[model samples]
Target: MTKLDDIDRAIVIATQGGLPLVADPYGAVADALGLSAEVVIARLDAMQQDGVVRRIGVVPNHYALGYRFNGMTVWDVADDHVEEAGRRLCATGVVSHCYQRPRLLPDWPYNIFAMIHARDEAAATALVERLATALGPLARGHRVLFSTRILKKTGLRLGRQQGGGTPCSG
Candidate 1:
């Protein structure tokens, strides 16, 4: 396994949950680490280059935000057309994630799935309509599974930090 130096580990520890929703999140992390922002950036950039940091992406809590209504729109697109369909759907800024997965022939026939978030049910439906128009004939049929509740919401932390997560409770 690749070892993380003290500084890199500190950076990961500070950001495991998320970066502060502030004007300068990197600066906040740097201050916490007692390192300059430039150095923090440089170290993170290096880690990313070396593949230590697999991905650095935003993790927005839509439910906590005004976008309380979320819809998992799944589509049954032609096997040959799903690729083009995914590319088109991705261009539709309303979509947060668009990807294909296996379909159960009997009960579940949908293969493509996209996540859309909105303030209410109607807005979420409207976005689904836009998605249908964007997907065109690539999609044979689709359904929007409206999220009724958020059972659990958390992120997958990589490796143990100085002061890490809690023990699982049965």
Candidate 2:
């Protein structure tokens, strides 16, 4: 990893939220940063090569985009098979994020979690069923936790990514 200079910091701060939605998003960022768009693109390319940027793209607001029903589905899987099951769940396309997480003893027993977005709960549950079939008996049990309201949706924040202190991810 390399220390971010002032210019790099400026670029990071300028594009942290995401590239501008326009015909020339990078150019827009460059204009704001007082640097050439070429420089911005080159820096971003280097960042990706260095693993400083993990992903870059539009993150649709599922709810606003008519994906009205989203479920944070959880499953209690056999410890040895959770990883493979997670991969299968991710391949389902309905799953936006899937990973294994710690479970609280005596209360919460789900070890694997996947987020599913859909137009309705039934549709989301159908995806969960697909995941269950993929996992077979390894998935001992499961539950789809649906949010009743949007209490919070944490937007992108800087300094959360690895390898660099800069904010930009593109």
Task: Report the number of the highest-lDDT candidate.
Answer: 1
lDDT of each: 0.85, 0.80
In TM-score terms, candidate 2 sits at 0.84
lDDT of 2 by residue, 1-170 (tens): 66766666667767777788899999999998889999998988777677766656667788788887888889998888887888888877778888889989879999999988889868877887888888888888888898676555435555634454534668
> What lDDT tens digits, residue by residue, belong to model 1 across residues 1-170?
45777778888778877788899999999998899999988988888888877677877678889898898999999898888899889898999998899999978989999999999878988999999999887878888898888765455555665543443535
TM-score attained by model 1? 0.81
Query: Runs in model 1 with CA error above 4 Å?
Result: 151-153, 158-170
Candidate 2 has which clashing residue pairs, if any?
none
lDDT of 2 at 121: 67
